[model samples]
Target: MTNEPTIRSIIEQELERRGYSLSSFASRSGINRGTLSAILNGNPPKPIAIRQLDLMTEALEQPEGHFYPLYVNECVDSDQPNRRRVKAFLLRCAEVGQTECIQEVLDRIVENLSYIPMIFEIGEELYEKGLREESRLFYNVVIESEKYQHSERLAISHYRLFRLSLGDDAEANLIAATRFELYLYRLPEDYQLDGLLHLANAYLTLQKWVQTEIYSDELRNLAKMVYKNYERAYLQGKAFQFRAERNLVVYYGQGYVLKGIALQFQRRYEEIPEYIAGYADLSWFVGLNESGKEEVEKFKLFAKLNTYNLKVLLGDQSIIPEYIESVKKHPPEILPSLRVIVEASNIHNFFIDDILEQFNIDTGLYDRADNYYRLEVSKDRYLRLFYHLSVYYLRKKEFEEGISKILITLKIAISLKNYNYFMKLIPLFERYRSFATEGQLKEYETLLEGVIKDA
Candidate 1:
């Protein structure tokens, strides 16, 4: 006999036939009323809490496993050994760029492992093979595993990999943010600059800008404490770079403009030219006319005619074409200090366009209808490109594509735990949920719930 009704639909219809409201059923079944409502409304249930499912089945007067079968398919013996064999096959397929084979392996693993992190090693290997989708699935499984039992290091590693491969997603970002917060709480007295850097970056991505600033300030203070040690002092500069990038992204003109002034105050006068130049370049890119130009020029004067001793002192290539033009036009003898500045300036200017282009995303702002993608070489550029592309497709009603790209971008932001991007994309997800598949829609809902909970 052909089965006329699907299991889920039949369950809902049966409950209604028995004259049971969701609230009444939930009360009887010991399930949360809201959860029952979500399930009845066709939202995907979280993996059934077995004890709760048992309660549900008992209340319905159904045999155990009647509502949901314990086993949906038969196990087949593969020619190879156990789950490891399956993992290896998936890894090999991923290595060879056989995405379908990788997916097939994922399906088998999911069926077998019930979404556990036992497959994480294979997932990490697949990530190395450029199978980002498969890798993310595996990482997701790990992240959702029993909290106390899960490997924190493995989770962090997978998240870093996810960020490297897929950019960021809401899930990974939230996971990273939580981990960072926990690490800070657990290591509140730890003076490790590295941990502080991670926390700062996480906070920055989460748009906890004040927290980021606090962590960054703490890191700098720690760096200062150990500055007598050359190696420790170098670590401070590294932390500065870390914070500087986030500052650049958020505050734009003001951040870069002030950074130039700060470098001068630190008595790192030789290194000031490039900061000045970078500020100028960003100002021009963002249509901030004549903003940092005066400060940049002031640095340029000291940069000229300061050759030989300068290289040994600064060791950076900051003062290239921009400084060179200032020197050559003014007919000053280029000093060694100035040459290093010139070189650094050239390198900085070379990357300014690539950097600024990241924020110049097309969000269907110029035109409301057409959809197109502009490819820029820098990874940083990809964020804005995907952001705009998703918006473009979304505005044109090409939702699947829009959602796909948005998810991809979200994955990147999550990997980075970038709060700014996360906030930016949540609305997009809501706007496009109508066009997403039921499964995709559920994922969006779960993501939204997670964001809200975290906030």
Candidate 2:
């Protein structure tokens, strides 16, 4: 059997070759001779910190990071690995962008299988510090090496990977969200609430109303169960057993709001009233703490806003003036309300020229790559609103403005890689092709060509 060289032996050989005594080596490496002696000669030699180990390797005329392989013996590959030393060393490897070193440590440690909990903790710490790329390495390691399929750590690792993977591509985001959704129920209640909500919203963004309804239904049920748990504890004058990422009210309210929106998109407008009434007034939702009460107030605002919204969607032209006034009172309500108003105008053949004109320039400025609003409205919502506006303008023979909106929506749909929006956009543009200028036609063809390449 071939034996691996130890750090002590490596230092001894280097010392003999260089003819440097401990005192001389200490002076060169800027470490105390006693500390060096303890590391090299103690009955069970002391653990060397990575910083000191790097210094010793440098004094031996070694290349940068050349000593990392030898140092893994000090961190792991022992009966009892030094956990503190291992964590610090791994973090330093990440900080210095030494991905290979991180992988090396992970490969050695995973053979034992007990290091996954520590690995997961390192992943969390790295994620919280905004080192997403480095954090991804740790989380992926946990996912691949963890032996227990149903463990919470495995679920959390999946969640972290999903979060880090989100980007500008709506198609990729949906893939990630679905992958993470499989593990959502494995999470603790607190995490499940957040995960299910995001999963539902992701489907909504991709215009998958059926999947949106499914997950949103899950969220509503889970949120109600959690509320009852809290309510029961409150009645008993005992502390609740759990907490969630947001106030309980947010989960409860958003569950209904999201499901309602999904149903509205599918034109199941009759079924939405029940969902709307779910959060319409939470004054009766018991046992709210101060933050929970704040969430309740926000739900009340949503209740009023969505009520006007529902009316307009049901083709109530009389409510347009009142809805416009309500939207004006709340800045965040404008985008969604505008979407409803524009779509309703097309449906009911009403005029909203003043409202459209008011927000035209600002709405027209949406970049294909980024979210224009500073609020909670997502890129998907913007894409929908922009498309419907194009339809409305085209119907009115406002080709210049209508074609402009089509091109804007086309750019956004391409950036998102959302095939559903592409389907809608291609048909709408084709119907109005005679009205488009040469440049706009060229841009549309180019965008479709890119989609073919991507496919």
Candidate 3:
């Protein structure tokens, strides 16, 4: 199980066991010697075509399809149309982590390339199941397959792959962004607009401020193009799936939010409040009260909460009490995943006398921490929430809790490889060093030592 043999490895082993030199075997099997050599010796061994494999089977006096069963144990016969069954089988193989088998099976089915859509569908399912690495393989297969080079599926695959890499790998994000831009020219304006938004978002994450601004402007211009088309359609008394005016509002508002988010990362707190208000107004108009047209209430609430958090970070504590009351009044309106962030903001600023309510929020956050890892776009806020939790515990004179929270904060910061943030927390830990018990302090020191060793 630790090192299951690949098809090529097994073939090589079988050839050596039979005392046939590779050249002799290639001549006997009627495969070109160079192609056979490449198949056997390539860095990632190339897959054998079915006809070639069958010829090798005959030459080796092996049962027909012998090599295939050894490699793709659970793979079905290569039928082009049983896409649903193939999708299920591939997902089953992926679930067991049989990457080699999956690749081999896919190669065997390449002659029936109509199954590519099913493969992409399976990839989407795998992504939803949290199998990112496995899902990425499926997407890569579609990208590499020659038949799909000019296909519209290429755009869809590139976009999904980009989403998978966003916030997790900057280099991968850039590569995906490039593919999206390259493939998007063949697509419609809607797709181009979405592609621009993705590029802008990625550049924002990379702190490429000039590039981000450029893409943001492009997105705004594309929205105008789409709006003009919508107007023409409206003159003919036609309807679009999405309202053009609503889309216009969203695009302009998103431009503000995107710039605000980039500014937040740059620590330009002064410029954010206006953008936040604009985004909030548009979000409410299009999201909640727009004739029940859009389901964007969560976005609206997040924008509202973000404005409040920014105010706290900017030393506007006078609003903290009102903010806390509003959040409590509409608890259901807040996204469950963001409840912890909102409460953490309150804990960071306002002094809460209701210990039970605070405990409930903390426990709720603990139960939902898994969601935090999946929220890569909100990583900065996630890190800040933990930092504030640490400070909250310290302020409350809860030494064990404070130390534990700070340690978790450091671990997350380090995992992100944000060394600047990691370095910043070192001094904060030292600032609260006196609050910890001697034993706790020793544990903290040991943890920091490991960070140095591992880093």
Cα RMSDs, all models: 21.4, 4.6, 11.3
- Candidate 1 — which residues are off by over 4 angstroms? 1-81, 100-104, 110-118, 128-134, 146-150, 161-208, 217-455
Candidate 1 residues 152-196, lDDT tens each? Answer: 534344444435432234346456556545434333222244455
lDDT per residue (tens digit) for residues 265-348 in model 2 = 988888988998899788787777798888788778787877887888878888887777876776556677788888988888
Ranking by TM-score: 2, 3, 1
Q: Of models 1 and 2, which has the larger TM-score? A: 2
Distance from true position, residue 311, model 1, in Å? 21
Candidate with the greatest lDDT versus the true structure: 2
Residue 428 deviation, candidate 2, in Å? 1.9
Candidates in order, TM-scores: namely 0.32, 0.82, 0.58
lDDT of 3 by residue, 241-319 (tens): 5522235555655666677766765667788887677556443332234533252453476587778767766656577
RMSD of 2: 4.6
**Which residue pairs does candidate 3 place in steric collision?**
none
Ranking by lDDT: 2, 3, 1
Error of 1 at 277 (Å): 19
